[model samples]
Target: MLLRTLSCLCLLSGVCLAAQAQEEKKAAIKEVTVFLKGAELRSESKVKLPEGESEIVFTNVAGNINEKSLNVGADNGAVVQSATFRNNYLKDNGPTPRAKQIEDSIIYLSDKRNLLQNEITAIDEQINVIRNNRKVSTEEKGISTEELKKLLSLVRTDMKNLLDEKTKTNDSIMKLNTRINLLANQLREENNRDDDPAGQITVKFYCKKATTSNIVIKYVVPTAGWIPSYDLRVPHINAPVQLAYKAHVYQNSGVDWNKVKLTLSAGNPSEGAQAPKLNPWHLGFYRHTPVSYSQPVYNQQTSDYTNTAQAGAIIGNVLDNNGEPIINSVVQAIQGGIVKNGTVSDFDGNYILKPLSPGRYDLKTSYVGYKENITTGVIVNSDKHTAVNIRLQPTDHRLEEVVVRDYKVPLIDKYSTGTGRTITSDEIDAMPTRNTRSVASTAPGVYDGLNIGGARGDGTMYIVDGIQVYGARGINPSQGSNAYDNTMGNYVATENRGVNTTFDIELPYTIPGDGKQINVAVKSAELLASYRYYAVPKMDKDAFLQAQITGWEELDLLPAQTNIFYEGTYVGQGYIDVRNVKDTMNLSLGRDKKIVVTRDRDFTMRSVKTIGSNMKESFVYKINVRNTRSEDIELVLTDQIPVSYYKSINVDDVEYQEAEYNKDSGELLWTLNVEPYKTSTRTFGFTVKYPKRSNINL
Candidate 1:
């Protein structure tokens, strides 16, 4: 009986000791590693444990933490028994500094409102007393006119002051209300859940003896990620391009990352790791086979980005002539003539090819206007970061022909979630649609200019050459608490689009503008064109120089006026109409003074005018064209005859030589091949008969 009683007493004592030895500690966030879609947080706390088991209650943990990723580590030989996570709904955690400032302002305004209310009440009481006193005095004695007027004036003054005070107080109250509302909105926008009350993590630990132990807790949260940005710079057209690899890491994961070491990864963790399989290989005639798939056939991703763990990384810029970065430049690392890895340059003209095997490699760089550059004997060591900056020379040969046909090529996107189209450097340089919104409208599914895929217009995120065109306040990894401005560089002009990502490039070209069309040059090519001089001597006595460039269907160009730069000079502006053009494109390069054309009256072969009940007039004209340039030239001379509106006005004796006559339009054309320093002439005569005294302005 004594032993049983002693054991019960000891058990009670042990329970009492455990209740007393329980420790409550809060962990301070020590480090955070933010990924592309989420962020991992590490926090530490120190606690003194009893010789037996003790419960450590950790406060201030994120409420939306992934419990599966929650882990606890112990130092100083303290063994962790178990850990539990729960929201600390009952804890009276103090408000954040910003929130507290807002609360304090609210309190102050509430006090002011009370003070105003009290003043209004006092004024009402004073007003009532004044009325009563004035009535009593008037009833006491009938005053004279001057005394009554004075009394009335005194009463008016007191009432007016009271009313004015009330009006001022009401105005102040309204202003305070407005300010409070604004403050509330500001607080909400800047909240980021840093104002959460509390969260608790109760960890049970055991130890052989009493000792102080440090516990570290870690978990991942989903509200944080990063973006890869690039800056590619080419020293010159022939020089190698230098690409700068950078990351813009942003996090709102309910914690601040201060002075923590950051390690970025190129792999997407949330993407499911599953291989795709074909249903069956059955090519039959119009058979509606019940082909069912867990994942859609079109939804399968071809590239497996699982190489981030095996190889090292290579990052750098691709620049062009004049030391500008080239946007959308292709950078590939090849080994044994096979492309092992490749990446496109971002806004900053930067490219990062990660998980590259350590060995001697050949890097190939290519851009729309630049010549392909391949550097052999480039070495990449294992577990090391190599900067393989590449530069490519400019090519004068332009791709002038693009066939209009159906291509089964599919676009692959890794970061985007919606559909978008890519605008190549050649395309950007080809058209003169200077409006960014207009340029973006060229993509399919974009509506009303910048409204992409039917989303809100403001939701359209425009990223240029890795920089967000619309600025935002994001957490700068290098500066945690400062603002990082997102400004599109002057050279950022070319583009690529994807489901979730839209690229705006920092191009090597520029077009200066002020409220006018920014006729920027995205790229230029010397297309093979047949030049000719076309003259209408009978109409304007001027000849237009035209260049017909075939195979233009390949250049994705819009119909716009192009600034013609011919023979190393800005000749003038010309129109390019591709709307109805099929196989050939015609460009008018303004007028040519070297191919002079003239129209004159032929007095030597005189025409006579006869008058009677009927009138007849005959006129003779001559056209002369000279090719003064040092090269042979081809030309077409056009002249027109008047079409009479009245039946009485009859035309006859039309003389045309070696020219095609169009009776419907009354136009005559002559195709002429003239040699250098040679002149050609053509003469024609036409007679018109009409009623007497009829004026025909011809």
Candidate 2:
């Protein structure tokens, strides 16, 4: 009886042990709230925990994960007594099932190719055997001509069929080989050519009871980020520009964020929230020794707007007067008395504000150079997603009223992903340089646009009226002084000097290792400009039409390359270096072939004389201009004569017949009023007296 009881107890103990042991469950990625530097990953599992101290593990999570950033929790009143995290290194962190299937397909194709190759070899041998006919004996040659012809026909027929089969086999083999190679390559790049898979995360949780509970796992992983970008378009000088704000989001978190809620925060979690402490400024007795100064440093451990709807989420887009999406526009939902920070609009001008308490709130949206759009009341319901779209009007352009700007862009714009300076048309007109790059460097945080490594970031573009007039070029900056200070958040006025103008932007962008341009909306504007024609016949025969812009200084323009178009045709491109210009700035549109010009030297006016120890040589030049256009044309013909630089050489006999000559620069100007097919002529003469044997560049 005692033995039988022992056996029953053993059987009961074994069954209890079997029921207590549980298989590990995996947590599927539920949602991800991405920030600039990192992301918040949330995963859930329908876990079945055994009663009384059972272990539940989640395997195969992102490998770039910050283990310390991981958080494990449970629902259904299931308590997590203790939890531990580790990489499942013991597990074969191989390719996905799909990748393995691709490899298997490749192997199968390789075998198929081998079989086809063997068939091809057989066909080749058969063809060779048929082709190498046994040499006919002398006796056999004596057969009848009809019989020989019949034999030759039969051999040709057999050889042709064999060759066809061989060709088909070869083609089949080639196709199989190609497929095999392609699948193999696909398998090789399964993990984006990464050496090893990001190991699975093993989360061991200790729960008390066998209950169906919800598990939430969160962690931060690298290679997950987004950049702020935008597009701006304006119709006319008086019209408001349409700005499309956007975010280029990318992540290699090893999980697809398909249909998951996402959030973008201006707050940085990597940076500690500790306020900086100010130490006493002790005035120490200084010595006459060498010393250095440096800024204070607190060596701290370091550290996109996707429109995903969360509970109590507010989603919308912002636009301008023309109904165009305004990129990088700011959206704020102010509740209570707290001034809450809002999400900047994405490239499509889309914005999402979520995780809010149900209540009525004030909403505001603002764009650069545009009036703010404010909403007095917006009701947000709990567990519900609300929609709110905003529209802003552009500020009127009052020429006389100088709106002293405090920044090149909006205060929050520079914090977006990459470094780029936007110069408005007004700014370009004020400080005219040779190219967009030159003018861009004047922005507070900008530095030598040309020196920016990699593909050129979208710098300030040169626009005439509302058209993009110029292409890419190395436009060096003119004389200017800039004091730059940049930090984490977009600085409103950190170490500021000069015009405080900035592009109002939302997110920070990054240039790739290849230095590719981050497509962010830059500074742009429109100006009002007059047209005329000027020509230097002695230098270039073509007459160049120019635009004389007044009130340019008020425009605050920059030196940049100019794209010239005339009467609707693209003439050409030229540089505008305003550093050496006087009053009216002339922007040469392009050469006018309709106006012909020529400078001819007439030897008839030449005369030589020996004045004391020096010899005098005289010469004459005639500038001829003609109007090739059907109508009358206006032209300013110009020429120059040699000017004596040394006292030893004298130039006195300077005669101008139909030209105005400048004594300082030896320049002769002729304003020609030529009718259709009419000609205008100007004659100028000058004499140079120099040392008899001294050479001159005449």
Per-residue error (Å), model 2, residue 655? 28
Off by over 4 Å in 1: 1-21, 81-100, 140-142, 180-199, 227-267, 272-698
Model 2 per-residue lDDT tens digits across residues 177-293 = 766666655555553423323345444555555678888888876445444432222222122322223333445555445445444433345555588999999898987984322
Candidate 1 residue-wise lDDT, 48-107, digit = tens? 888988888887576646666689999898999998877666666656554566666667
- TM-score to native of every candidate shown: 0.39, 0.41
Top of the candidates by TM-score? 2
Ten contiguous residues minimizing lDDT sum, candidate 1: 451-460
- Deviation from native of the Cα of residue 552 in model 1, angstroms: 31
Q: Highest lDDT, which number?
A: 1
Report residue 44 deviation for candidate 1 (angstroms): 1.3
Q: lDDT of each prediction vs. the true structure?
A: 0.54, 0.53
Single out the weakest 10-residue window by summed lDDT for candidate 2: 479-488
